[model samples]
Target: MPATSYLRRLCACLALGLLVGCRPEPAKPLDQQLYVWQRQWRPAHEQALAESRADFSTLRVLALQAQPQAGWSRALVDLSRLKADGRPVIAVVRLDGQLPALDLDVARTQIGQMLADWQAAGLNPSGLEIDHDSASARLAGYTDFLLKLREQLPPGLKLSITALPAWLDSPQLPALLRAVDSSVLQVHAVSNPRLGLFDPVQARKWAERWSHVTERPFYLALPAYGMALLPDTGGVPLVESETPLNRGGERRELLADPQQLADLGHQLRDKPPAHLAGLIWFRLPLPGDRRAWSLTTLAAVARGDALSGRWLVELSSQDGLYDISLVNVGNLDQALPPRVELSAEQCDGVDGLSGYTLQALPQHLVFNRQSSARVAAGGRRALGWARCIRIDQGAWHVYP
Candidate 1:
């Protein structure tokens, strides 16, 4: 080959290499944060907020509720008591869809009044977020309402909306996005029992699709809370309220698994979309809220830690019978074994509870068919009592 031809080939190869090297890498995963939705106002929540403030960039507070007849009902959140520690706060106002027709003027007036009231009380919020799950047919009305509300907001105050997944492909979504500073896509909700809440696969697809269509940055909201459902005679699961019911029914709980959240974190870290701002938890964790994730579990999940199950077996004596309680002391949910056998020299027979089936063996009590014994993290369940010939000190072994 001639010297000129060889030089040209070398130069072309160098240029191609340079172009490949200069190409930008995929974006990193967004930071994860919390959303405070508890309105009862407890000191423990305040402490948790103070301690975990470093993990979050902003705190979202529930400030108002839009009603049909009354217009807007102010939620009893004591803004003065919530210490932000210099972090910005976004006041979240929820809309109850009880009105047959939405009045844009009424919404604007109520929002303006609430903002002014906050200003008067010496609370300066950095943003205002509207939480409304609008149907596809009502997207136009919802967009118009948001536009009017945005006009009345104080200058320099950012506006945001909590968006439903079903409305992502609607043509009116562009109009609504244009009217707000940012939109939060809530990926966790309990509309069906079979699918459970927080389908990670579906959520990832939605995030990818939204990123391609929108230029505005958005946050992906994940769940840290669980739901308790009770099946009626018709076999439909009904959500249980905080109040106790007079009727007897079987209860089942759906918890947000830490492993699932950690897996999602890993996926996002590898190839997070460009338009994703970060992740926002549905609500902050409280120690007393059994349905919500614990602070330790949340931190571990955010750090992309793989969780393992740990069980603690405790034996208690009541009415001349030995009761065994299986407690999940770890930060992950565990599936109860199909059959659990306890071997003890002094045990004769065992009695089954509502959650498990019991069988008597030669020298052990076999607990079988435990289909409903799923225990949440930090939850405890009694494994029924064992009937013995007499009470005496003896060694016990558990077999899976």
Candidate 2:
């Protein structure tokens, strides 16, 4: 027991304590917001907004839009249904991409009237978000338009814009960023429709680059919906979202995976970029929204909760006819099964709908999925009907 041994042990203990003290704490969870893109608010919105309150804290409601020669169209938002409590609300002004020019006079008139209408409804919007997809070459003109619009806005009212990554290459980007109090960098449906709906890797890269350009706080607008591609004679497919075109042809669906978005959010929060404030999920989902995520699934993703999916085959019978449907009884969204099989004593007049084809064999009927389809959490998908004396519900199976 010498003095030298005691000194060595004391020095080792002090070093270990320093190492533990220097370890950084975990990052805080990012804020969550929603884009209420529905032009016509329904009674269902009451329930949706109430359920979303526990997770999301902001609402970017679509207020009005301008067409090429159609002047302006205002959304039929029921102010009473939009009881967002104390959450911040931002009114979004959409400018159609087909417009040949940016008309500040029209914008001033349109936005002023829209704001007055909102005030009449007792909606005190905290900000104005200009949703435009101006070309990269037009950033200079866009910046000028923003500056002019900012002057017309009420004093102390915040101004923001929906930005695209294509503008990242523009030399006048910094000036454009300076014209707004904030920006929402949209990373979905910014490219060719054939490529895909969204790419998390590209989204991350865009956010990192955007952080390097603007000093103002910003948020990322991620997709929580799907789009359908309809075949056209011009070789280019027409993209449909939230609205259905009554054209009669097989359409391919492109959905933004919820799991992918959840993972991206986790990564961004783990190591947030400079001035990156929060996440704004595109197109808040309604109960009957076919191309959007369910409220249960979306809420789980925003809270970074665990995901587990359970799909069950359900059969409803009426007069020797059995209707087959896939029910998602779990809290996780899942891809539709590639194949569905049903055992029956005898079935006739078999058919399939909603992206499936029916194949009838001796004692089993196979519903083969021909395109990509997704089943939302706590949702159902029809797989056609069967005319049989008995449908063996206990023997049905679904194959991925």
lDDT of 2 at 345: 75
What is the per-residue lDDT of model 2 for residues 1-400, given as tens digits with 9 covering 90 to 100? 8999999999999999999999997786788999999989888888888888989989999999988988689998887667445688999999987789999998899899989888887888899999999999888999999999999999989999999999999999999999999999999999999999999999999999999999999999999899999999899999988988878887888989888998998899889999999999987898768899888888888888877898788989899988888899988888888998888877777899889998888889899999876687888999998788888888988896
TM-score of each: 0.74, 0.84
Per-residue lDDT of model 1, residues 124-208, tens digit only: 8899998887887898988888887787788999999998878876988888788888889888872477578678888898888
Locate the minimum summed-lDDT window of 10 residues in model 1. 390-399
Root-mean-square deviation of each candidate, in angstroms? Answer: 6.0, 3.9
Candidate that scores best on TM-score = 2
RMSD of 1: 6.0
Q: What C-alpha lDDT do the candidate models reach, one value each?
A: 0.75, 0.89
Model 1 Cα shift for residue 347 (angstroms)? 9.2
TM value for model 1: 0.74
